[model samples]
Structure formats: C-alpha cells, structure tokens
Target: MDSKRYIQLLKKFDGLDADTEGENTRSSVSYAILSNSETNQLQKCLGARLFEQGFQPKLIKTEFNNFATDSLDTEGELFQSDLDFVFFVLSPMGLKETIPSELNERSQFASSFLSELEMFVKNFSNKGVKVFLANIPETSERVFGNMSRIYPASFLYQIQAINAGINNLVAKSQGLYLVDLASKANYYGLSEWHDNGLWLQGKYPCHPRFFPTICDEVSAIFSSLVGKIQKCLVLDLDNTLWGGVAGDDGIDGVKIGDGIVGEAHVQFQKYVLDLKNRGVVLTIASKNYEDVAIDIIENHPRMILRKNDFAVIKANWEDKASNIQEIAAELNIGLDSLVFLDDNPFERGIVRDHLPQVCVPELPEDPTEFVDFLTQLNLFETTQFSDEDLSRSEFYYSESERKSLQKNAVDLKNYLSMLNMEACVKPIDEKSLPRSVQLSQRSNQFNLRTQRIDEMTCEKYIKEPDKFCFTVDLTDKYGALGIISCVFMSLKKDHLYIDEFIMSCRVLKRTVESLIFNEILNIAKENKAKFVVGEYIRTKKNKLVENLYQDYGFENTERSDEGSLWRIEVSGFSDLDTSIKVKRS
Candidate 1:
C-alpha cells in the first residue's frame, strides 16, 4: 500500500466510534507511544502499517513529559490496562534540555538520566510489557563544529555515550529493545529525514515525508515481538536457484558458478546458506522429477546448499501450494512460518492467492538485485538467539529419523521403549529460563490454553510461593532435545489451576504428554487439593490439542463460545504405566 492510502485509512480509523472501532479490531494488541514531541502523525502511520500486517492496533499517546506518571489513572491508582508494548521515542534536543551544557557538569546529568530510564524500563517490564527505547539521534546543527569531535562532554559525544549505554542495558535486560534511529537517519540522509522549518514551528523531530520508513521499522519490531517471525524459506529449483531449467537444458547446460549471470545465482545461494547457518530452515518445493532433481543436487559442484542441508525436499511435479503444505506438516510448523521464493511470476501469484499466510516477496526483474531486495525485506528479524537455535536443523533431522523408527516398531509401547527416552523436569531458573520463554512464544500445535509470556513473568512464577513453573528436557538414544515442554500452574485453597501447558510438536506421540499430566496430578495431590482444573482455549493453529483435557480424564464443567472449562478430582487421578525414565530436580 502507498503512503497516501495509508494516511487516508488512518484518518478513517481515527474518526470511528468506540463501538465500531472495537468491533473491527482483530488479534488485539495494546501499545503506547511516549514521546516528548508531537507524535500524532507517526502514530497514524504506525497504526496503518500494523493494520496492513493483520494486527488490530490499539494505541495510546501520552502527553509530552508524562512518560513515568501516565501509567496511573485519574484516581491515583494503577490503571487496569494490559499493554503488550511501549515505545519511548526520544529526541536528542528533548533530552538536552534537562542536561547542563557545561562540560564539567555533564557527567552527573548523564548518570541521573540513565538511572531514570532504567527505572522506567524495569517498572513496565515487571508487568510483562516489552519496552523499546529509541536511541537519541545526533543534532543536525553542529553547535561546536570540529570542537565537538575532540571534546568528551560535547553534545555529540554525550549522545553517542547515551546510545552506547542503552545498547549495554539492552544486552543485559531481558525484554528491552534498542531502536537504532541514528543509523537509520544516516542511511536516509539527515537532509531528507529532518526539516528545520517544520521542526521550529511544530516541534516535529522527523519530517512528514519519512513517516512511511519510520513506520516500517516500527512494524518490523512489532511483528517480531508477536511471534510473526518466519522460520522456513521454500525455494524453487530451475531459474530460481540456477540460470536455466535443469530438465530441459540438461545438468551440464544449466548456467551456474562461472559467468556473471551464473554468479548472481551463486551469490544468492551463498546468502541463503548464511540464513540456514543462523537457523532458518531451507527447503525445496519444485515441480520436477524427484530423482532428476536429487541427482543434480548431489553432483553439482557449484551448489552452496547440498541435499543434506534441506530439512524437506518436495521435488516432484505437484502444485506449489500443496507442496508447501506438505513441507509445513512434515516440519510440524504453521503455514505462516514458510516464505515462498520463486522466479516465475505466475508461480508466485498462485501461491499468494492459494495460501495467503505464506510470505512471498516479489522478485525484481533483474536477478542481480535479488540478494539486495531480500536483505531489505527483513522478514526474519529475531530479538533472541540461543544454542538450540543453531542446532534446530539437526533436531528436525532427528525427528524424521524417530518417525521412521516409529513406523517400523511392533506397537506404540514397543516403539516408545525402544527409543530409550529420559525426561528431566526442573523448576525454572537462570539456566533454563531463556528456552522456557522461547517454548511459550513458539509452540502452537500442542498448546492448550496458549498464554504467551516474557522472561520476567516466568521468573515471577518461579519465585511465587503459590505458583509452580517447571520445564522438561528430554533425551533419547538418538539425541538430546533441549527444553521441549513447559507448564505453569497456580495453587489455590481448594484447587490447582493450570495456567499454561505447551509442548514441542516433535515430541508429541512419545508419551511425553502423559508423563507431564501425571506430574501435574502429583503436584495437586501433594498440596491436598480437591480438584485440578484445565482449559482448552481455541485458536486458529491450536485445534490439534482442543480435546486434550478430555483425553486426560478431565470432566467437562462448562462450555462457552470461547473455550471449554474442565476439572478432574484429585482422588480420581490415576497413574499411567510408561517405560520412559523420569527425574525431578
């Protein structure tokens, strides 16, 4: 969508009535914009972009200089609003007003400024709200000119110090993110990003023409926070990965790895290899003979990604959409996680029309620009990375091997026993907290009552007396699957309520569910509870686990349009016999 159309839609939404606005909002996300300058134009641009990305954005803009105190209501009590994200949009001039211009007095002012910012971030993060701190941009007007470069306490030096300090804080903090506004301004050129005439009259830091670029960055950050990050990249074989069709032109005739045109595809493949190394799954969904494609992939010396690199290869004469669905099912991920890349415009259009969830970027007319175009899209922006992420492709390969073993076993019990599985259940601590939060954010298919949370909330559950939060790490004879399941339960006087239950889809049929259910019963029994309650919250991707409570002997208590409530008496709980070993810590 164009910038003018986006502005028009924002005006239409701004004029909507309360009831009509509430009715149109889907997948509701509450956010706040705290800025010292006029932010109505930026907020409108952000809302339009977020809405285009399928989020129903509900935003509140605080008055200038009210960042700390605006969270409270008019009665001087804490407000009941549940905010998902908060953006602190700070301009260098706004912060300069509070700090002294004298070189000798600047150190004390910097200390106090950082302290106040840290306190504000901590206050909101304790409530599970993600905070985005925009780095202060440099002043367009150089007051000291060349002297500012040498002086330690100059305005430019102070701003750079603050940005460095913010980066350090974000590195240590769990839920705080840094927006590099200075680098973005430098890229777009200061002359185009800032207008001195408009800034002097209206106090607008950024020019109106660059609102679209600013909002695109904001939209990318918002998408990453809400688990909209893409996981897999599905590629086509002929003309997409090489210079020509392999089947028609023959393997030796296909241009690759020598000339300028072939070097473009080579560079593209090298870029894709980098993505795979960072943990994005590489896949192939081509419409060629399976054996013919595999033979070329195995023998081609210039190929950056070989046969072993792909998690799933659907190289048959099938429709592209169906091939993508098969890949999703095989990988046990949502369709939204896949990004389809094809050189043919017709193929791209077919996938876009049939499966709207998949992200399909428009390839430029020149193949030489493909790498630059994909890099600019930033479709796989992630805030956190772990050791498990680096080894994710290996984990999927292990899962495929496990499935083959399951098919050959005599029965369910024999299959599980032969695998030799061991589960370690432990309370959430410093070492296990990162993976636990990741599982909460990523798991979808086997999740019952999906409750997304941040690291602070997971830590709170671990420290609270009446709450029980634990993670399960499983290892078999094949390999170690790190932190596959998580459970959060709240203990009441008469009953234990299960707040969240989620497990990785790779370990679904190995009786891990039964083991976790038994552990929950044990906790309830130890607390002398009368009943244990569970819920099945329906979602677009969680239908696989809708009947989970029923399968676990939890009697249905009430049914609603939203979800079903279930309860099982402690006395009625019985243990199931399993061959896997369990250790509690």
Candidate 2:
C-alpha cells in the first residue's frame, strides 16, 4: 500500500482501540517499547498494526528517553506487567551523544555498550518474558570516503562490529530475539527510512510512516504464539508458473525458460522453491486438466518445480475455492495456514470470497515483480526453526498414505501395531531445546495448558532439582516425526504437577498421548510422589483436549471458569494402553 493510504488505514484502526472502545472482537496482546528516543508514535503504529491483523494490542507506556533506566528498574512497566513481547527499539541517532569521536575509542565503547545491554537482556529473560532487541541501524557516515570499508575504527566498520555483537548475544541467549533493524533499513533504503527533520523536532526513531514495517516484523515473531503462522503456499498454473496456459499452449508452447517473460516466471518459481525448501508446503490449485498441467510440470525442460515438490496437486476445472478447501482437508491443516498466489484477479477474488481465512496475495500483473511483492508481505514468520522443518512437506504427504492404511485396518490397536511405532523420550537439553520450545509455540489443538516455555526457563528447569522438562520423539512405519510431544512438570511436596503438555496434531489419534501420559506417571513414580496432578486450561482451539485429564483416569478435584484440575494417586494409576515401544535416551 502507498504511504498515504497506509496512514489513513492505521488511523482508522487506531480509532478502534478495544481498550477504550470496548470492542472485543480481536485477540488482545500486551506489549511495551523501551527506546532511547520518543516512542509514542512507534507504540501507536504497532498497536494499529496488531489491530489490523486481528489483535487488540494494549500499549504499555514508558518514560521518554529512559530505556537504560527502565531496563534496570524492576518496578518499571517492563517488569511489572505480563507481556507477550517486549521490544527494545534502538536508533543510531539516539547514540550520537555517547559515541566516541576518536577512532581508537570506538572499540572500547562498543564493548561497554554490548556488555550493559546483555546484562539487562539476561535480567528480563530471567523474568520469563520474551525479549526483542533491535540492532542499531546501519549507516555510512562517509568518515574516510571510499576507505571506510577497510578502516577498523571508521563509523561504518564500528557499526558492523556493534551489530555483530548484538547478533552473537541474541544467538546465545535463550528467549531473546533480534529485530534486524539494519536489514529493514537497508531494504527501505537508509535515506528514505530516516526523517532528519522529525528526529530533530521530536526524537522519532526513523520516520513514523515506516513504523508499520517494524510493527509487521514484530507481529511476525508473535504469530506462532497465537497460531497465526502460515505453513503452506498454494500456487496457480497458467500465467503464474509459466507464460501461457498449459492446456491450450501444450508442453512445448508454454513459455518457461527461454525469454524475458519466461525468465521472470523462473525467478518466481525459484522463490517458491526456496519457500518449499524452508518447510513451506507447496501445493498446486490450477483450473486445468490434470494430465495437461502434469505433463508441463514433468516434461517441460525449464520447469523449476517438479511434481514431487508439491505436497498436494489439484489440477482440475473445479473452482479454486473448492480446490483450496480440499487441499487443506487433505493436508489436515487449517485454511488460515494456506497462502494462495494466482495471476488472475478473478481466481483470487473467488478464493477470497469463499475461503476468507486463506491468505490470497494480489499477484502483480508483471511476473518480475512477483517476488518483491511476496517478500514485503512477510507471510511466513516463525519464532523457531529446526531440521524437522525441512521434512514438513514430506510429513504431510505421509499422512495421506497413513489415511489410506487406516481405511483398511481392522481396529485401533491393530492399526498402530501394524505401523510398528517406537518412541524415544529424553530430557530437554541444549541439543533438544530448539524443537522443544518450538513445539510449545506451535502446538495449539493438542496443548493442554497452552503454556509457551522459553528456552531460558527450560534451561533453568534442567538445573532445578524439583523441575523436569522432557520431550518425546515418535517414529513409525511411515517415517520419523521429530519431537512430536513435550511435557513440563514440577515435583511438589506430595504430587507432581504437569505444567504443560503439548503434542503435534498429526500424532493425535495414534496412541502417542497414552505413551506420553505413561511417561508422566513413570516420572512421578521415580520422584516418589504420592499423586500426579494434571490441569487443562480451556482455550478456543484446545477443545480437543478439554477432556484430556478426564480421559486418562485423572479424577477432577477442582473446577472453575478458567479450567479443570485433576489428580490421581501415582501408585494406584495403571498404565494407559499403547502399542508403541519406548526407548529412553
């Protein structure tokens, strides 16, 4: 969107503030900004952006030019309130007062600056809050003309060192995230991003006009928390993957690799291929005969994406809306997880009207601009990524095969035994922490408490004698489902409490839950606990597990508006039935 229209939309959205307007339609998130510059405008932009994206975000205000003091003050809003995310927005302009003029002194200054910031980051992370610290904007002050690139003490070189230090800090620290302001500034162009006049007048961090870009970046990080992350990218065939319709142009006539238009299509396909490589499930929804499109994708020499790359292919004359719905059902994913890209406006409109939850980007008329458009949209944002992401498409494809087997199986136990399932249970450590925390963020329907445990807290649990954080990795005849379940527990005086239990939806009906629950009982027994307590906090998406504790022979001891609480005697509890064998690591 253009800046003018964008500003108007934000104003309208900001006016719809649920905090004051009492409109409770969207999910609400609490966030605060700690910046060394004026951040009222940044808060406004972020709040509006969240509201636009189906969230009613509450802005926690902070003192002006007091980021350092606020970071140290435990009584400040940064520490006092519960927040989904806390952003430490930074700007080079705000650091002008403290920066050293002498080239020799910059190294010392950068080290001191990072040391202080890292200490504060640790403090906040200890509070169990997710921290987002923005890397300072990259700048070329032209201190030594063309030689600035080589000079060790030049401003450009020093900024690079500082950003690198920030990168290293966030990399090692659990629950801390870098906002990548340098990359955003470079993308928007340094000159166009900052407003000198506004900075001088009110200490604005960059231009208020581009604040939405930063807000969007922040929203992407929290998207997984609310289960808003997109996992699939669905593509159209004619004019999208190639220059002409595959049905009418035939395999040889379709322009794919030899001309200007064909090269543009190839570049777009390359981008889509990159998404697939990063674990975005690719699917085809083309309004054409199956053989014609399949022939072009398989036989055409210039086709970058082969038939195997797509998890699902619906090449028929059916309306794209129906095709996309079938694709989601076949993959066992929500419609909101799908992103549709088609060159034809009519198809885009049809999908939007019928499947409003699916994200349909307006593909640019020119094929060359396709990549840039999607890049700016930031459709796929994730909090954590693991090697398991690379196999996501294959994982879903295997589900279809499993369904075929399920149709012919005699019973549940027989089906599970036929698949020959095995599970490996292990404690959360440095190696398993990434996927452990990721499952906490990603699993919604199967999450009992919906508790998102950050890495730092998980590490603390590993060290604490009374706390236990462990995960389960499942494998069957189909393939390995890496780290499909996780359980967080703490030993009380007389009982073991299950803090969080999350599992992948793909493994729901496969007796994996029974295996994990059995593990929980074993842990309680090992700890010599008298009782095992399980709690289920109600959520809109977690109705699948509303009766989780009840189903597992946990007697309900307490019930309230929030959820139900159950406990069972560890010694009296019998093992839940499961076909899978266990392996401990």
Candidate 3:
C-alpha cells in the first residue's frame, strides 16, 4: 500500500466504533508504549495500522524514561494499565543523557544500564505482559568521530555492548522480544529515517514518513505472538509455480529451471519449499487438469517440491475460492490460516472477495520480484521451531491416508480400531517441552480454555507440585502422529482445575478426547482432589469444543458469554471406554 493511502486508512480508524467493528468484541488489544523520546505520533500511526489489521488498538503512552522505574514501582501507571503488549522504544541519543560521557566510566555505566533494563523486563514479564524491547540504533551524529569505531572503550562500543546484552537477555526470556530498529532504519536509509527538524521541534527520533514501515514491522511481530501466523500456502500452478500454463505449454515448455524467468520461479519454489520444511503445509489450488499437474509434480526433474510435498491438491476446474475452502476443510485448518498466491489478478480477486479471511497478497507485475515482495511482507514470523515442525508435512500426509482408510471402513468405531491406534501419555519433560509449548501456542480449534504459555512457563508448571502438565503421543499402523495432545491442570486444595485440554483436529472423533479426560480424572484421583473443574473459553476458532465439558459428563457450574465453567465430582467420574490401546510412561 502507498504511504498516502495508508495514512488515509489510518484516519478512518479515529471514528470507528471499537465495539461494533471487527470480527469479535475481543478484537481490541491493549498496548502500552514507553519511550525516552516523544511517541504521540508513533502511537497514532501504530494504532491506525493495528486497527486496519482487524485489531482495535487501545494505546497508553507513558512519560519518557518511565520504563526505567515504572515497572519497578508498584504504584506506577505501568502497573495500572491493562496491557497485552508493552513496547520500550530506545535510542542511543536518549541513553546518552543518563549514561556517563567519560570513556573510562562507560563500561560500568553500560553494565548498570543492562542490569536495570533486565530487571524491568523480568518484572513486566512476571506480571504477564509481553515485552517488545527495541535495540538502540546508531545515531547520525557521532561525538567521538572515527575514534568511536576503533576503540573498544568508546561510547559506540558501550551502545554495541548494551544491544548485544539485550539480545542475550531476550534469548533466555520467553516473554521478551527484540525489535530490530537499527535494521529498519538501515533499510529506509539513515538520511530518510532521521529528521533533524522533527527531533528539534519534538523529541521524535524517526521521520513521520517512515511510520508506516515501522508499524508494519511491529504489527508482524505482534501478529505472530498472538498466533495469527499463516499455516498453509495455496499456490497456482500456471504462471505461479512455473512460468507458463501447463495445459497449453506442456511440462517441457514451462519455464522453471535454467533461464532468468525460469530461475525466478525456481527461487520462488525454493522459498516455498523452505516454508514447507518448517511446518507450513503446501497445497495447489489451480485451474488446471489434475492429471497434468500431478504428472508435472511427480515427473519434473527441475521441480524442487515433489508430489508428496503437498498436503492437499485441488488442481481442477473449480473456482479458486471454493477450492481453498475445500482444502481448508480437508486439511482441518481455518480459512485465516490459508495464504493464496497467484499470478492472475482475477483469480486473486475472486478468492479475496469471496473468502476475506485468506491472506491473498497482490502479486507484483514482474515475476522476478515475487520473492522479494513476499519476503518484505514477513507473513511467516514464528516464535519457536521444534522437531515436530520439521515433520508436520508428513503428519498431514499421513492424515490424508487416514481419511482414505475411513472412507473404506464399515463403521466409525471399526475405522478407528482398524487403524490400530495407540496413545502414549507422559509428563512434560525436556524432550517434549518444545512440542508441548508449540501445541499450547498453535492449537485453537479443539482447545478448551485456549490458554497459551511459553516454554519457561510450561517448565515452571512441570516442576510445581500443584500443577500437572503432560502430552499424549499417538501412533497408528500408518504412521506416528507425535505429541498429538496436551493436558494441563492445577490442583487446588480440594479441586483439580483443568487449565488447558487440547487435541489435534486430525485425531478428533477417534475417542482421544475421552482418553485425555479420563487421564485428568485419574490425576485428580491420585492427587486426592474432590472435583475436576474445566473451562470452555470461547474464541473465533474454538467453537468445535464448545460442548466439550458437557460431552465429558461435567455439569455446568457457571455460564456466560465469555465462557462456561464445568465441574465433575471425582467419586462420580467414570472412565470412558475407547477401542484404542493406551500406554503410560
């Protein structure tokens, strides 16, 4: 989007009714910004961009330098604001005022600064607010001239040391995220980013022209943190994966390897393949004959992605929008998780108009710029990568086989039993911690309570006696569906509260949910608890599990629009029968 049009869209956000607009009442995200420089313009620009992206942003700007002390002081405004994310924007110029200017004292000053910043981050994170800490960018003006570059004890070295320290701190702290402001400034050109006039008039560090770019970066980070990451990339075969239409130009004529245009498509394919390797399901939603597309995918030597790469292939004459919806249903993923890429503007428009949730990026006029355009969008930001991610495509492929087997079975129970399913339930340990955290972060549709936590928090729960965290790994005759489910519970005085009970949608309708419920009851029994309490937190995607508690024989203790609370007496609970074999470790 152009800058002027982007600003105009932001202007429209000022009068929008925060309650009636967007998909849900919870569309609004409360964020607090603490900066050493002026941030009113930044807040307005960021809020506008966030609002445009289906989020009603309510921003609370704190006084400059308040981040250093506000988090430490219990009575400060930072503690009072109900915020989902906290942004601490820093600049070398702002730090210069507080840190000692003397070269000999700078090392001590840098250490003290990092210590205080680390404490602030820890305090805010302990309170459950996600922190976005900005790396201090090198200022345009240099006080030490060339001396700053060569000397390790110079002011520049101190800033570099502090930024490196911040990176190390964020690596260990799950709740803290680093925003690469220096890279952003470099990308926009230092001259274009720094406005002396604006800095002199108001303490604003960057020019107003660059706010849209800044907003885009920040919004991408926030989007990934909130679990809005894209899961599937639906691609068109003709003029998308290759340089020409397969039906008209034949597989040999399609440009995908040697020349300039061919290499461009090949690069695009390589990027898509990289995404596939990291858990993003690849699918074909093209308007072509299925036989021709499948032949090319299987036989083409230049193709980086093979026939087994795709989870769903809809290469028929069907409309793009209908094909995408069918693909989502077949794959058991949400429409919002699909990202459509096509060279034809008409096809893209049809999908965009019919299915608004799917992220359909506007293809550049030139095919060579496709990779660069997609890279700039940063649509696939992720918090963590695990072993399960590397094998996700295979898991989905196995699911496709399971669906075929289901169609051939005599009955639902017969189908499940024929698969020879066995579930191994075990406590969360070092090996399962990463996948367990991923499940909590990504599982939405079948999740009850929808509680998301980081690896640190998951580890903390595992060590706490009152808390119970375990994962279920399922393997059938077809393949091993690793860590397909997770259960988290808190044992209070006489009650066991189920904080999260989530299962993969692939294993739904196989009585796996009953197995998990029975396991929770058994844990409650072992803990000598009187009641097992469960909650159903309603979300845009979790409607599939709305009646989960009632289905499991838990009586509704309380009900509201937000969610419902259910409880079952330990003595009254009975184990639900399932054909699948169970193993505990």
List clashing residue pairs in candidate 1.
Answer: none
Supply the global lDDT for candidate 2: 0.84
Candidate structures ordered by lDDT, highest first: 2, 3, 1
Model 2 spans with C-alpha error above 4 angstroms: 18-27, 410-412
lDDT of each: 0.80, 0.84, 0.83
* lDDT of model 1, residue 439: 80
Tell me the tens digit of each residue's lDDT in model 1 across 1-585. 235754665675575334243344358767777776767777776776776677777776556557667543333222345777877777666677777867798756656777778887777766677888888777766677887755667777777777888989898998888777887788777777666677677767677666666667777877766667788899998988888888897778776799987899999999988888888988999989988888778888887778878888889888999999988888888899899999999999999999988999998867799898897678787767876777777777677777778779979998899989999998888888877777888777778887876787888898998999888899998888888999999998899999999899888778888889889999999989899999888877788988889987899998886789999999987986666699998
lDDT, candidate 1, equals 0.80
Which has the better lDDT: candidate 1, or candidate 2? 2
lDDT of 2 by residue, 1-585 (tens): 247644764686567643454354466888888888898877777877777677878778886788888878988767888776788887777876678887788757677888988887777877777788899886657778998766776767667777899999988877788888888899888888877888899998887767878888887877765567899999999999899988788888888988899999999999999998899999999999998889889989888999888888899988999999999888767788899999999999999999988999988999989989998888998877898898887787787788789899978778889999899999988888888888887776888898777776678778999999788888889898788888999999999999999988888788888888888999999999999999999876788888888888889999987799999899998888888899998
lDDT of 3 by residue, 394-462 (tens): 888878888888888979988888989999999999889878887888887988877777766798778
Displacement of the residue 22 alpha carbon in candidate 3, Å:
3.0
Candidate 1, 508: how far from true, in Å? 1.6
Where does candidate 3 clash, by residue pair? none
Q: After superposition, how far is residue 294 of candidate 1 from its true place, in Å?
A: 2.4
